[model samples]
Target chain A: MIAQFPALQVVIPLLGAPLCIILRRGALPWLIALLVSWAALAMAATLLSQVADGEIISYALGGWLAPLGIEYRIDTLNAFMLLLVAGTSSAVLPFAYKSVAKEIPQDRHYLFYSGFLLMLTGLLGMAITGDAFNVFVFIEISSLSSYAMIAMGRDRRALSAAFTYLVMGTVGATFFLIGVGLIYAVTGTLNMADLAERLPPLYQSRTVLAAFAFISVGILLKLALFPLHLWLPNAYTYAPSVVTAFLAATATKVAIYLLLRFGYTVFGAEFVFNIVPASEVLLTLALAGVIIASFVAIFQSDVKRLLAYSSVAQIGYIILGISYANVTGLTASIVHIFNHAVTKGALFLVMGCVAYAAGACRLESFAGLGKRMPLTMAAFVIAGLSLIGVPLTAGFISKWYLVLGAMEKGWWPVAAVILATSLLAAVYVWRVVEIAYFRDAPADAPPLSDPPLALLVPTWVLTGACVYFGIETSLSLGFAEQAAIQLMGGG
Target chain B: MKHHLIPRVIAKLTIPGILLFALYVQFHGDYGPGGGFQAGVIFGAGFILYGLVFGLENLRKVAPPQIVTAFIAVGVLLYGGVGVVSQILGANYLDYDVLSAVDHDGQHLGILLVELGVGITVAAVMMTIFMTFAGRLR
Candidate 1:
């Protein structure tokens, strides 16, 4: 039973999605989603602990061998990701009851939960699956479900936003498929482990190089890296608050994991870095993404849109870490995956509460919110501080590693840019803080207090984790270091 | 239009045959090219043709929307349930060899059941989508 954790990790939620539709009751589907997510988190914990020593667990679906069958592979990297994604879902679900009920129509609530579970299944499956084709399948599953969930937002713009994402995301997926097909054409294998073994000898082949290019661009678009990030701000802005929270936290993080897996494990660091100069390209883009996206974020009027752009900038920092392509750089990349997830997830959830009580996620709605929703805003502040890479917060730990990584390479300019971007982070984060804390309530405005305990508790829980993971460092840092070492050692 | 006797009569004549062929495709999936997805679409097309020629209300009388939605859930659960059953029997998820005393028979039974699940879902979903867009006209 314990050995089957990898299969069960994905299978449980895949089944739970249908169960949600079958039940079709108001609270029943939500409860089912909540349970399935918590179960996934628990399983992830067990999987992580089991793989903490850098061991790998591979489970073959349908009892077929790995070269042919769909395999669920869990290593320290993905197990940690599974933990982040599932844990974020679990935290966000408890907060969803009020926010979802407030935003979405009553009739669609069951469908909403069903979509949530499907998205969870897709994200977790992507993290755990060892097959290249299976990653594409899970990416579609997660993207399709998310498009539906995003379209569920009350505003009609949600429809167009979803359509925009649909088009861009489909193109991205197609490019990735073409890349994978190219690789399979050359190597005749879809298994990541097998592909790694076969890929090195063919690294100089043009087909393999084109395959690498397509796959990198496809994943970059999905990851919402700077130039390719047009679909994200609106999708995140218009999505129902819970959808934004969950997708913001986990979806792109999984894409980053996919990028790292392909870039380091399958393609091999030597091919990606030394032979192809992929590191230099990625490093340049990362710098531009952080500076430009942060500039864009500070100008947005809507709070959700602002945070959405901030998310793009944050993704830049992650890519910045990745572009360094060393042990410390990879560690920063991995730890930031967990750090940014908790911080941004908490921030979006807090916005969800604001949306529930104030009826908008715009900056104007946040006026005098500090007095009314002190605790919620407080959680927002702490998570906001974390986003700025303030000391004794999770975001700080990521930046610390990122700076060290840049310095280790004697890239002093890159290290300076990392610090400069943190100030940009401070600007965007402070925008909301200023409105919430300094501005006075309008005369005709109704009184708003903290949201229900159900909402506040989950928001704080994630917020507290931002600080806790910062100070404690063992669970997230230990696993991140282990994952970094394993990736560097090759799959 | 109900007044179109020729179209209605042709639909009636061919729908049964279409359904029959769908069944054949579903059952022979393990050996042939036609499987759950293709079989399911063929089966659903028969009903969709009926709804188009005979009117949605008449189609609704024969197959309600609620039941169609329920069947979608049922199909997925059925498919997933088979995998769980295999797992409980100490094989990995979807390991069909443990489903019966004979390994070959278990694999056959497993494929057949899974295809059946897919057929049911695709058929129901096809009809549901037809009804939704077709009903939107009224």
Candidate 2:
């Protein structure tokens, strides 16, 4: 039974999705989603602990062998990703129950829960699956559901946002499909380990090169790296608050994991970095994403949109860490996935609580919220500080590693740029903090306070995590360092 | 369309034939070219033909949205349920060798059940899609 943890990690949520639809009711589906997410988190924790000892756990689906059947492969990298994604889902659900009730139509709650669970299943499956094509299938499952969920938002613009995402996401998925096809065409294998073994000799082949290009671009679009990130802000801004929180935390992080997995494990670092000169292009883009997106984040009037742009900038930071290409840089990237998931997830969640209590999430809505909703505002401020990479928060730790990584690589300018962006982050974050604390609420505004305990608890849990992880790096940093070493060592 | 006698009569005769063929294809998938997806689309087309000639309300009467919705979830459950059962029986997930004491019999039963699950989901999902688009048209 314990051996089946990897399979159950995904299957539990997969089953819960349909069960939500089968037992469609107002709260029943939410209960099912909540339970399923908790179960997923539990399984993810077990898988991570099992893999912590440097053992790779692979479970073949349908009792078939690895090359023949679907495989759920978990190592230090994906096990940590599993924990991040599942843990986010678990935290988000308690908040979602209240958030969804307010944001979505009462009758459509079951549909929302169903889509939520499907998205959870998709992220988990993508993290765990060793089969390349299976990731495509799970991406579709998660993507299609998210499109629907995003479209469910009350704002009329949500429809267009979802449509834009649909177009971009489809093109991205199609490119990914083409990449997989080309790889399969050349190598006649889809399993990651087998492909890793098979791909080394064909490093010079143009087909393999094109496949790498396609795969990189596809994942880049999905992860919303700069210049390819036009679809993300609108999608995140207009999505229901819970959807925004969930996707912000897990979706792009999983995409990053995919990029690292393919670029490091399957393609081999020799071919990916040294052969293709991927480092410079990725580094330039990461720099651009960090500086430019942070500038954009500063001007947004809607707090959700502000946070959404901030998310784009943060993705820049994540990529910057990745583009460093050293173990410390990779560890920074890995830890940022967890750190950003909790930090950004908490910020969006607090925004949801604000939106729930205040009717809208515009800049005007947050004015003087520091007084009106003390606890929620405090959570927002803490998470905002984390977003700014303030010391004793999770964000500070990642940036520390990122800057240290750049210096280690003798890229002093890159290290300087990383520090400069932290100031920009401070600017954008302080914009919100100043608005909330310095201004006074208008007389016309609805009287507000901290949201119900349900919303507040989850918000604070994640906010507390931002501080806790910043102080205690043993768990997050330990796994990240281990995963980074494995990745850099070409395991 | 409902008032058009010739097309309606033709549809009435052809619908059952289409359905019979769909079931045949659905069951014969293991040995032949037909399988769940092909059979599902064919089966769905028969009902779509009924709605086209007889009206969607009539189609709804024949197959309620509630029941069709149930079929959608149940089909996936049936498919996944098989995998879970195999896992519980000490085989890998979806490994059907243990479905029965006799090895070949287990394979036959497993594939049959799995195909049935797929056939149900595909057909029901088709109906659901039609319901959504056709509902919008009205």
TM-score of each: 0.99, 0.99
- Runs in model 1 deviating more than 4 A are none
For candidate 2, the docking band is medium
Ten-residue region with minimum lDDT total, candidate 1 chain B: B69-78
Best by DockQ: 1
Regions of model 2 farther than 4 Å from truth: none
lDDT of 1: 0.93
Candidate 1's displacement at residue A200, Å, is 0.7
lDDT against the true structure, each candidate? 0.93, 0.91
Residue-pair clashes per prediction, in order, are 0, 1
lDDT of 2 by residue, A87-200 (tens): 999999999988999899988898899899999989998999999999999999999999999999889999999999999999999999999999999999999989999999
- Model 1 per-residue lDDT tens digits across residues A33-64: 99999999999999999998878998999999
State the DockQ, from 0 to 1, for candidate 2: 0.77
